[model samples]
Target: MKQGARGSAEAGDRSPVAAVRVPAQPRAVDVDRERGIVSGAVRGEHTHSEQPLPRPRSAVQRSSVRGQILDALRTALVTGELRPGEVYSGPGLGERFGVSATPVREAMQQLALEGAVEVVPNRGFRVVERGTRELAELAEVRALIEVPVMLRLARSVPAERWAELWPLAEATVRAAASGCRATYAESDRAFHRALLALAGNEQLVQIAEDLHRRAQWPLVGRAAGRGRGRGELVADAAEHMALLEALIARDVDVVRVLVGEHFAGAV
Candidate 1:
């Protein structure tokens, strides 16, 4: 089972936010690898009678291959390309991605550890099902960790440091306005990751990110069904900017309230 954060501090006495270090965007090589795997069949490079044909095993970089497959699978999970309760076999996904099954299995195991998938006895892995109750529980946990941390950062971090996050915040809003769930989700994660990193606690940032990723999984199907429209996503983006502004202004009250409201309505 995953562990939650322990202990809390008063926001007023917390230290200022530190310099933010945003993760690098996914490289084109990763995208090209996934595209080759997923689209190879359509392009007649790795297909036979409409069936996917796996690429030959070569002395390619194993670590890079695994990372790319992981990225592709994560995207599928977040975009509803992989559905809840759907069983996906390692070899099956491997063939779809035009790679061998080893890397695919490795990738799935990592996802299983993250609670995104569960291993079956003889079958492959299944996407874990999440409903309203699960979502609420996730939101509550997020609020517990994020509310206090954000409030502390808002009080401590310099306004100039908070201002540095505007580009990421704006990117998220733009993604939402574009009405693309995948783009918005990626941007949303980036924005939050940047914000939380200011707390200068790596472990806390990781835990919060895990919760955020879990929260996003349930939205895939909804996003696909139009259950979450562009307006709602845009509103979400706007709230992110508002929260950043509040943090910059050192309004702990507004920051606290915004953090709670953000988690409550995140789904």
Candidate 2:
């Protein structure tokens, strides 16, 4: 029956059946690409807090929600907005961030992997509190790793390379004067990275930056009970410039001394 029916339909059946044409339909819009998704350009009845946090840098626009949240949480950790030993729930933070808890939880787990926080079973993630001794040890280790590198770069690198870093050192100074610890801390890191990069050791830069970041955890308002405040940051930023100057002059003695003083005050 199937073969006979197929033969009759194809070979020219005189049946009076007419073919019906289907109409084309509009394509569906991807929900994530809709206006409110990416930029602050979201248009709708969203209240202020419901909007995404402003990302001043264009590079941040390319980041996923998880990466953005990670950065935001890191900034919170540094600025002491997220206090040490405090437990924060993913859903609660997600609401503040105008997103779902999935991204927040993902970001928090990344922080956990970085040793910045620890999971609290069903409760939430608790910020890891560092004692003075831990911070001191981190600073000591960082100094031991970086001081010799700086001295070597100063002695071997051309003066032109040191001059090229003036902008980075100056950036730290500007960030310090702006009274934003997070900003200054970033600039401070950039300067150190650029300095060590002259030695052509990629691993050295990564390790040094890791220690620097750990030293910066949960500072708890540098002016409050245990805060170091803006003055100390400004002084530290100024040392970057001073250290660069010594590096350019190829003053290994001065570079070693400056590097020592800088790390000594890191804790």
Candidate 3:
């Protein structure tokens, strides 16, 4: 959920780009827009044999393919798969994606615009890392943007809509109780998405979605596999319930305080 220094990224012996080798199964993607990095993969749902084993494939499959590749790439970058100062080439990535250079080039260009990749003269792209201070700033920006949005949604959203959210919150709790990190993580995200659904602001939702993706960068699925204790998980669930109650009551002060506390604890 946090970004680290480029020097920290450099310390690892493994080539940053090597981690981009996709597992056989689908995994999470974490993208840090503020730091221009991304990483993470799903965990706890698969054994080693079930990892997303990579294979050659065509980019012509569908728009989703490009989107998936972008997601995968973002996950890698955020998770340090493509670490800072690491060299990357479009053609090399095309080979990895089983596509021609065109799509890879296009994708890389898009990432560059997003500030995730830097084009070096006569070289390919390099994953740039942020300083600790920069990472902190990123977190601050997220807090500023998300806390208010959640509070506003809390005040305006109605009770019946909360029924839709309860199931997702329950799912997160169930996943946490079962020690299924990936499932828990997905459910956890779904719960928040459910809350945001009431906002009816497409641009805000998109922004929040991007921020959530960045938050995933720090630990990948590790958070799910080794989540908070059961009591803590229940407490978290209860907080959501409290939010719903406040929404049902149209208690703006209570909702704002609850959201602030929840995010302070969670983030």
lDDT of 2: 0.69
Residue-level lDDT tens digits of model 3 in 106-167 = 67778887767787644466666545444445556667877787777766666677666777
User: Counting only residues 3 or more apart in sequence or on different chains, how many pairs clash (N, Cα, C under 3 Å) in candidate 2?
Assistant: 2
Clashing pairs in 1: 16-156, 17-157
- List candidate 3 segments past 4 Å from native: 1-64, 170-190, 218-254, 265-267
> What is the per-residue lDDT of model 1 for residues 1-267, given as tens digits with 9 covering 90 to 100?
001112111221132322111134233235446656433222223111122212222223445888777776777677666778777766455544545555777899999999999987555677897776677788899888888888778878999999999999999989999997767888998999999999899999899899988888753344435345689899999999999899889988888888888887874
Model 2 lDDT per residue over 1-267, tens place: 111245433422232222111123111122225423431112221222221222222122233767877887888778766777777765445444545555677899999988899987655678887777777899999988998788778879999988998999889889998988788878888998898888898999998888888888854333235555789889999899898889889898998899999999987
Error of 1 at 157 (Å): 0.7
Indicate whether candidate 1 or candidate 3 has the larger lDDT.
1
Quantify all predictions' global Cα lDDT against the true fold: 0.70, 0.69, 0.55
**Which has the greatest TM-score?**
2
User: How much is the lDDT of residue 79 in candidate 1?
Assistant: 65
Q: What are the C-alpha RMSDs, in order, of all predicted structures?
A: 15.4, 18.3, 11.8
* Model 1 per-residue lDDT at 182: 69
